[model samples]
Target: MSVVDVSGATTSRVAPFLQGLAREPIVWLIVLIFAVGALTSEYYLTALNLENLMRNVAVIGLLSLGMTVVLLTGRIDLSVAALMIFAVVVGVIVMTEIGPMLGGRWLVRGNTYAGPIIPVILVALATGTMVGAVNGIGIAYFKVPSFIMTLVSLTALRGFNYVLTNGHPYYLKAPLYGWIGDSKVAGIPVSFLIFLLVLLGLIAFVNGTVRGGRFYAIGGNEKAALYAGIKAQRYVVLAYVISGFCAAVAGIVFTARLKSVDAPLAAGYELTAIAIAVIGGTALAGGVGSPWRTLLGSVAFAAGLNLLAIWGIGNWYQNLAIGIVLIASVGLSRTSRKKTHS
Candidate 1:
């Protein structure tokens, strides 16, 4: 009787844990990939490589967080990469113009500003927010499909970025501007730390708040959410605004890290963001995902790319691998949804 009781207690505790793990197999997949990498490469498990990998994925990870939210709402934003480029370009230009008026030197061989960091950051974030508002308005008020609306924004914004810079890259001369990307806090990159904070905040918002639950409700069943008296359009618009703000933040960090911004910077990143979110186990049909899983997906993506680089794979093959992974993820999501419904 004692043995049976002990066995029953163990089963009761472990069954739910196993079921949770089964529900998110991607987590296990990530673990497996890391194990393989550690075993295969002498440098893969080193602290330096790990840090570099985190830094490399931080921007995409930020974008993925926003993408996850949008996906949760049964929508998508294809203009995030272009918005990032536009924000960086506009921010840098505004800072350059303001720095001279503020009595700062024209540093870096006459092409960069030495001050106005705060104002520039604000301008960039505001620009992204405004663009997001437009996207939201068009979709919510005008009843436009999110895919088409953002697709048009993507094209127009990319063109605007090119027109603003005339196809040339803008370099920031201020060390302070680059510090966010270059500096470390307690042996961790500042950019990664920022990413970590954003991730945590978003997790709190989505999992711990009623407002976040509404987003899921809307995505899961729009008619039901509307019947429940939730303002579906407002929440959808808010999601886009959040996505735009995130893209702007990513742009600033990316520019600081690279010390330069180009009109074409982060091209194709929207697709990559979507891929990361979907691969993280977010349902493409919407209403099922977590930011924590998206973070793991981003890390897995960065790791795969790093491994490819180490093995001397070309960019084309990298893209191919990403496509395959995306297809598989979407298929799995669809299957899971069907099973749940059945």
Candidate 2:
């Protein structure tokens, strides 16, 4: 081949490949992080640690799934962690109150009720949905900025959680709840499996459903979506509802795993979830990103934490490491967007 022909062909093949890498830089970042972990620690690549990592990331991963959808619509849900806590609190309270009515006794073994698990799960989900609906209505119809709306909800819901629990944690002795939170299937944790199922469901909804695209449209340009006959408000509201539902599910799973529910159960998890979503290449500006990316982000975050622990890092340094990761992820996201647009 002529020199010019060879050069042109190489450019043609390599340019698209480079572009693809730029579009999803987090994938490379995750690979790099994993490589570093594997090189630095003998235990990092062990199956037990990997399983523990998956179990650890499950709640945050589930929260990030909902947050990704909300961010896709150019909104935020600061109340998600609080909502999760509140949902679990409500579920525990209901179980405590209703166990006797259902001819079930409070199990002294774990200081938990031996009540029907279904009712507790339903109530937790419903609580999250209702709270989410209120957040949606305020932001979508009332024209409240999502940041402020969800901030208000964060405070209110957290207060409610405290009030509901009387500043104490409730132990759940229900075997079924424990199973949902702690059990394993085919060598995988149930919580992780639930997170994976939610991740898949979200991926399908966002990529395959009309309503899912509507969220992107609304985030991409609300005024334009509205002009195009899309009920932008409703979809925005739906996004919050989804977030709330995810929070509720996370709450239940977390409670089951810990075998207890506390007022501050998931405090500050909202920030971690947001960081995961943003790190996963989900655009903070909206109209871009996917569940798959968020999943990668969640895994990366978990891996980083595991590495820190293995290195004998203290909790203080661990948090600092997360902050650094968050900043780096945001910088990478901005750089990628610039490259794509330019």
Candidate 3:
């Protein structure tokens, strides 16, 4: 065959494969959510309930986005929860600085501007980036396995958490901060809106961006990518950074919901994120899934939790449910399911 003909055939073959791979998960999952939600509960079909549910998943959803990247690299980061706790401490401290506490020990409603929100947001993002870099550096440069490196950070981060807050619960003193957690715009919760936007942007990036394409390449075959001169270390660092940022964002959502902070916050969140990632159809072996699917897994799992909570299920049972999901999710690991991995 002529060179031109060969090139055209290759392009045609590759284009359709990418397009089909991208389209199926999103289309099927959206339809499935509505279909199932509509059947199970009256709350599921309502606009308000779904909005709250989405808001509920937003923080974890955000974290799972980063987990998706980490898992994509065929590596895992176990310290995201610690960083999240750290970010909440920073965010609460920033909130106090923005407005004085009304009762010395308590914050009365209808009070001060919760700080610009941007500063806290930046702090969260920055903290996440730094934490991720630490994980990436340990794994990529020091030759540590990602699991061990992140586990070490997990211990250190938990320590930093207590030090940051001085072992006290921190509460925001500003009323404006309330907007981030509970306020609605145009009849929809802003927190949920932000989560949706972030989700959509991530979906597009995974499907279209050059850097994102490299993520899939690295996840699919890191050795091949290295041989092809792809900057593997750079992408590894970027993945951890993204995961860290996700943890920070998740803390924002979480603290906003409670309007309080604990040094031990998100102590088990990293596992939940990983579980969501796995249940979302992302394999533990890496390179076979996307964010939206991870998100769908999150929604299905989260909604089930909420339903359980509403049914008056005890916290003990709730723990058991989560454990089941985690165990089942790990079944999707390449070690167990060879066909799924392929």
Error of 1 at 110 (Å): 5.0
Q: Rank all candidate structures by their TM-score, best first, as comma-separated numbers.
A: 1, 2, 3
Off by over 4 Å in 1: 1-23, 103-110
| TM-score of model 3 (CA atoms) | 0.81
TM-score of each: 0.91, 0.89, 0.81
For residues 198-280, write the lDDT of model 2, one tens digit per residue.
Answer: 88898899988998999889878888999999998889889999999999999888888888888877777898998999988
How well does candidate 2 match the true structure, expressed as C-alpha RMSD? 6.1
lDDT of 1 by residue, 1-342 (tens): 334588889999999987986777677776777788888888887888888888878899989888999999998899999998898788877777766687875445645555657777899999988888889889988999999999999999999999988887877766677788888889898999989998999999988999998889988999999999999989988888888988999998898898888898898899889999998888988899989889988988888888787667999999899889888888988998999999
Order the numbered candidates by lDDT, best leading.
1, 2, 3
Question: Candidate 3 on 1-342: residue-level lDDT in tens?
Answer: 635688889999999987875675534655666676667667766777777777878878888888998998889988888888787676556555554554342224433224556666677677777878888987888889998999999998899778867776766644555788888888777777777777788788876798888888888899999999899888888888888877887887777777777788777888888888888878777677787787777777677777776567897898788889789778746554586447
lDDT of 1: 0.86
Which pairs of residues have clashing backbones in candidate 3?
none
Prediction 3 global C-alpha lDDT: 0.77
> What global local distance difference test value does model 2 have?
0.86
Query: Residue 337 CA error for candidate 2 (Å)?
Result: 3.1
